[model samples]
Target chain A: MSEYTATVTVRLKAGVHDPEAETTRRALERLGFDLSALRAADQFELDLDAESAESARERATEMTERLLANPTIHDHDIEVEPR
Target chain B: MSEYTATVTVRLKAGVHDPEAETTRRALERLGFDLSALRAADQFELDLDAESAESARERATEMTERLLANPTIHDHDIEVEPR
Candidate 1:
């Protein structure tokens, strides 16, 4: 069993109400940072047992789709790296 | 100016009070996930302009240290990719 690391990011779909992101954006604005296209996302780091990078990516994808995320209102990106 | 993409992960130092992480972990436990070492983190994606990956990474590191995060209580890892 090789040690593989997976980083998964989950973000609310565009047009979804992201209170956390909004709050952060407003705070930034108050601090004099002006960038309107700000979004909030969640990141997960998983240490998984996998034989190869391909397998790790596939498994991470499955984990996101099956359990870690709500696909209807969220989008995810999975990155796998060897350890 | 190349279109460089950066993903910055900000995590609370271990032993810090992470209310959000705790809440999520409890919810997962209630759903029958028996994992004990669950932590939460934040990810930021930046479109930066630089001549090389090293420069992009350096800029991102500086950004995290200077503005995007509170280094006193948070740790950050920056990843740069081509867009």
Candidate 2:
């Protein structure tokens, strides 16, 4: 087995309310940045041991489903590469 | 001016305590994923208007410095593309 790093990007599903993003946009506007709209996401990077990139991705996907992302309101993508 | 989208990825600086990331890693480990270490970040996407991509990037960078990222403990990257 080899060490690998998995990158998971979790984003709110379309139509989901994102108060943090809204608050961030307001803060930017107050600071004089002309932003019309905004959205936000959570990214998680995990280090693990796996036999191959494909296996690493599989573990990352399962991890996202179980903890890294809330499937009811979030969607996620996983990328794995050798560490 | 044209509409553009800016993607900002904000991550904790090295040595910062990341409780949320720790909790996530614990949850994943509980689910049988053998992770060694983990880090987490917040990503923000903004829609705005600018004269060009360069201008858009400049605005996004300013936003990151002032709002999207906390320079004291966070590092960020900004990417802008025409919408």
Candidate 3:
């Protein structure tokens, strides 16, 4: 089996409240940094044994959809690469 | 001034314990997904008004270094693009 790494990124859906990111933005502003909107995303990297990159990505997608992200509130994307 | 977007990705330094990622990995395994190591990252997207992309990137780097990341435990990267 070939070893691969899958990167899964999750972000809150549009209009979802992102308090942590907002707080972070405010903190930056207080430090004299000027900026506008700030959105935060969660990225997950997974190593797997698979037949091919496609298979690894498939498994990672399943993992993302089922456990790594909340479908109702999060938008997720995945990328696979050889390890 | 022109508008730009800065993407700052924060990841735990190698050897840092990531319990949340571990928990998510275990949960994925229980659901029948096969995988090895899993790492999680925090990504921040910021909008800014700057004289140039270089300036926006500089500010974003400062934000990442000062407030968006904990240097003791995290390593971060920043990307700047026109908005």
Candidate 4:
């Protein structure tokens, strides 16, 4: 088994309302930062033992599908690297 | 001016206690997934008009420092690309 780190990034689907992002944008504007749009996401890094990068990605994707992301409202991307 | 997207990733500093990640790791284990360690982070994507990528990255870093991340407990990385 090889040590691998799977990075999963979960974002709200397009056209979905994100109150947190909206609030953050307002806060940034208040701080005199100029931005047209902002979006927020959650990222998870999982370190585990797997046979290959593909296997690590598969497990991470499964984790995202089952627990990390809401299928109806979220879109996630996963990347795996040897550690 | 050109359209750019600044991606900022914020993670807890090493040795910082993260209850959320701990909870998530346990949940994954309950679901029969094997993971030795897990860490969670927040990612922000900002879309803006800027003269150059460096300027966009600078603004994003400032945003991270002032609002997106807590300098006392979090470490952050910023990336910028043309949109």
Leading candidate by DockQ:
4
Q: Could you tell me the lDDT of residue B57 within candidate 2?
A: 92
Off by over 4 Å in 2: none
Q: Please give, for residues A4-48, the per-residue lDDT of candidate 2 as tens digits.
A: 999899999999998888887788778777778999988888999
Task: Find the candidate with the highest TM-score and give its number.
Answer: 4
TM-score of chain A of each: 0.88, 0.94, 0.97, 0.97
Question: Comparing candidate 1 with candidate 2, which one achieves the higher lDDT?
Answer: 2
Candidate ranking under DockQ, highest first, comes to 4, 3, 2, 1
Grade the docking of candidate 1. Answer: acceptable
- Candidate 4 lDDT over residue span B10-73, tens digit each: 9999999999999999999999999989999999999999999998888898899889999999
Off by over 4 Å in 4: none
- What range of 10 consecutive residues in model 1 chain A has the weakest lDDT sum? A31-40
The residue pairs in collision within model 3 are none
Name model 3 segments beyond 4 Å from true: none
Tens-place lDDT digits, model 1, residues B1-83: 57677778899987789887667656655765443244668877766667888987887777677677897899888888887
RMSD of candidates 1 onward, in order: 4.0, 1.3, 1.1, 0.7
TM-score-superior candidate, 2 or 4:
4
TM-score of 2: 0.94
Query: Is model 4 an incorrect, acceptable, medium or high docking prediction?
Result: high
Give the 10-residue window scoring lowest on summed lDDT in candidate 2 chain B: B24-33
Every candidate's chain B TM-score: 0.88, 0.94, 0.97, 0.97
- Please give the lDDT score at residue A26 for candidate 1: 68
Q: Select the stronger candidate by lDDT from 2 and 3.
A: 3
- Residues A6-56 of candidate 1: C-alpha lDDT, one tens digit per residue: 778899988899887677656656765444245668987766677788987
Pairs with backbone N, CA or C atoms under 3 Å apart (clashes), candidate 4: none
